[model samples]
Target chain A: MISRLRTALIYVVLGLGALVMVAPFLWMFTTSFRPVAEAFTLPPRWLPGLDSSLESYRRLLASDVPIGRFFWNSTVLATTVTLGYVATTTIAGYAFARLRFPFKNALFALLLVSLMVPIQTTLVPLFLLMRWLGLVDSQWSIIVPGLTGAFAPGMSGVFGIFLMRQFFLTLPKELFEAARVDNAGHFRTFWSIAVPLAGPQIAALSVIIFTMTWNDYFMPLIFLNSVDQMVLPVGIMSIRDPVGNSSATSEVIAAVSLSILPVLLVFLVAQRWIIDSFVRAGVKG
Target chain B: MTSIANDAAAGWFSPQNRKETIAGLLFIAPALIGFAVFVAGPMAATVVLSLMKYDLFSNPSFVGLANFEAMLDDRRLWKVLGNTAFFAVFAVAGNVGLGVVLAVLLNRNMSKTVQYAYRAAYFFPSLVGLIFVAVIWQFLFQRDIGVINYYLGLVGIEPVRWLSSARNALWSVIILDIWKNVGFAMLIATAGLQSISKDYYDAARVDGSSSLRTFWQITLPLLSPTILFLLTMNTIGAFKVFESIVVLTNGGPGDASRSLVMYIYEQGFKSFNMGYASAISLLLLTITVIVTAIQFALSKRWAFYE
Candidate 1:
């Protein structure tokens, strides 16, 4: 009886925790469907009724804020950066894992140490470098740095390299030796043997990099200033009237909901892989 | 003549060695070049820039530690530092504590479906961008119309000014941060808990050890390394809190919610004090490194592997 009671208690606790976690998102979803006056109603309706309208969403889509353009820019930037990161890390990881060269260890060590430096330390100089290149207001300012792996400590391509290197190290050396005996060059061996076997790691890295670049706010905020050039996060921030007279709460809520839908959908689809990757990374370390 | 002969005989310049070197270098070239330009070069320049006064419009004049000296008297710097430290402490504690509790609850003898559902629910918040988080939480904390205050009214508590008041704004941001991040900590802790051999629990049960005692003796000690990892990462992340502040309060109610990183942005971009901003950034970098080093040193006492 006591054991059964304890089990019931655990379920109750878990259920309550889940409620706390899910309620706000539920509220946001409902409010997006609500009219402006209904959204701010004193009773705080949890569900939209007959008064709920799609007008807020329509207004959000039609607003002069250029929401679609921002979305496109963010998509292109994130996809390009993810591809670039995967390519750079895979090759660098392979080199670090399999190749023998002078200063290899030293260079790897430098990369690891660079992970400790804060992004704030690099912001000013990177901005200046962008200016020097005449790319300050261009999307290239964001894309170039992102593709080149100029990321913050935990979010950097160095972490990706580390993950891939660890994965590559677990592969058998005989595979590479077989390729070399077949008169294969290093590139051929990597492309044929190593790349084919890296499916899981590539999926893991791609999802992670895509998510990181998509949700990134600081880099885009600093680099791209024009309203039309803004990414989603910055663009969302731009929608607010600075003088505080805006009564578009419902519209803003709609915008927020729409902005996160892509990532939310991606997370819903690839959540298993994402969680598995994090678990493997943590447990192995 | 002898050296030349030896060099030729050593095979250092042989085709095989040359091929290996070239391939290796080529493979790493993209990352190396990117790192040198975008990361390393900027890092070196920050050190130089911190020592000089530059305003983007003017040729930078050598200031020779004036920026660092100015930080001594800058009250805003001190305030933001205190705010950041306060945030890190509360946010890290809340995240780790709640994460452990949630992990423990899920790790218990639950159905697989139940476990996955609860995990997904908790993790959903982390998927949204910080901007959305800020916006959603802002509406929730709205004074008269918010769901939070509505519930508070039901419980006969007064509606608190969550973001408008100076005292509560920082804590509001901290709460939202904890809400968004605790799932990550929970995931790490769950992994840690799952990895422990079931034999430890079995032996403890055989020895008539109570569940609480087993948790204290077996679970926490075994999970210390994962906890340490979460601690270091969480501390670094909390120190760099910027987006939530920008989106939620914009350092409002007279700078009560401003973080160190946000302050750096204001100085560098808003005030155009690039030199001083670099100095403050270096301070942030120094603090992060020191905090991480301290965590590493302290981890030896508790974190166990094998």
Candidate 2:
């Protein structure tokens, strides 16, 4: 009886915590479907009315704000960056793990050291470099720096390299030895053997990089200047100036709801791999 | 005879070694080039830029120590730094404390479905964009019509201006930050708890130890490393808080919530004080490095490995 009581208590606590975690998102969704006046009601209506207004979403879609363009820009940018990061990090990680090269450890150490340098320190110089290349206000400014993986500490090339290298290091050396004995070169061995076997890591890395790039606000805010070039996060903020002006409140809520859908969908589809990656990374550390 | 023949075939300059070396270099070239141009080069330029006074349009002239000197007398610099420190302390403590509690509660004796559901719900906010997070919380924090104030009014409390008041703005951002990030700490703490062998708990039970005693003596010691890891990471992240502030307050009614990174952005991009911004950036870099080093050093005293 006591054991059963304890179990029930645990469930109650867990349920309440989960509600707190989920309330903001639920509120955002309901408010997106609420009319402006209803949103501002005194008691704060929690339920959508029978009519279920779509005016906010309609205005968001019909406006001259180029919501569709912003979505397209973010999607394309994130996809390109994810693909590029996988290719670069995989090759580099494999080389570091499996092959002997001159000054390899030193170079790898340099990469690790660079990870500690905050992005703010490098922001000015990088911006100047972009301006010199005449890439400011263009998607290339975001994409080019992103290609390097040094744009942010968390999603940088160094982090990906470390993750991939750690994954590759655990593989049996016999596999590579056998491939070498069969007269396979390094590239051939990597593509034929390593690449085929890296399904889980690739999936995890892709999801991580995709979400990071998609949700990125700082880089795009700094680099992209025009409406056509702005990403979703920045574009959403642009639509609702200074946050809570009653006129755009519902519209901004609608936009926020829309902005999170892609990431939420991706999370639902890949929750296992995504959650597992965080756990594994934490345990490894 | 075979060994002799193999030795003869593999000379000082072997084809296999040469091929592997060339392939490795080619494979790592993109990463190396990227590091050089983007990270290393920029890092070097930041130091030089800090020493020169150059706006984007004009030639950068040497201005030795002026920017650094100006930083000392800059009154707003102290305010921003204080705000950043205040934010880092509360945010890190709340996230680490709450994360450990949640992980302990959900670590055992739950159905698989319930476990997954709780994990998903907790982690959902972290996956959303910071801008969206800021917007959602902004709506909920509106003094007149927000859900929070509405609830407070029911309980006979006055409506608090969450983002408008100077004193409340910083705390509001901190609360939003804690809400968004506690899940991450939970995930990390959960991983740590799961890794603790069941044998330890079994041993404690055999000794007839109470649950509280077992947690204090066994679970906490075992979980210290994870706690330390979360502490360091959360501190670094909190110090660099930008997106939430930008979207919600933008340094606010009187610069009450401007973070170091935001100030750097304002100075460099808005005021065109490139030299001053670079100096401030270096200061931020120094603080981050020193704080991280201190945490690692302190972890030695408490974090258990075996």
Local error of candidate 1 at residue B236 (angstroms): 0.6
**Which DockQ value does candidate 1 get?**
0.59
- Angstrom error of the Cα, residue A27, model 2: value is 0.9
> Tens-digit lDDT track for model 1 on B1-306?
232121334454576566666788888888888888888899889899999999999899999999999999999999999999999999999999899878887887768778888888887777677877888888788777778999999999999998889999999999899889888889889999989999999999999998889989999889888888888888988999999988778887998989999999999999999999999989988988998898789788768876
Worst 10 residues of 2 chain B by lDDT: B1-10
In candidate 2, list every pair of residues with a backbone clash.
Answer: A149-A156, A149-A157
lDDT of 2: 0.84
Chain B alone, TM-score of each model?
A: 0.94, 0.94
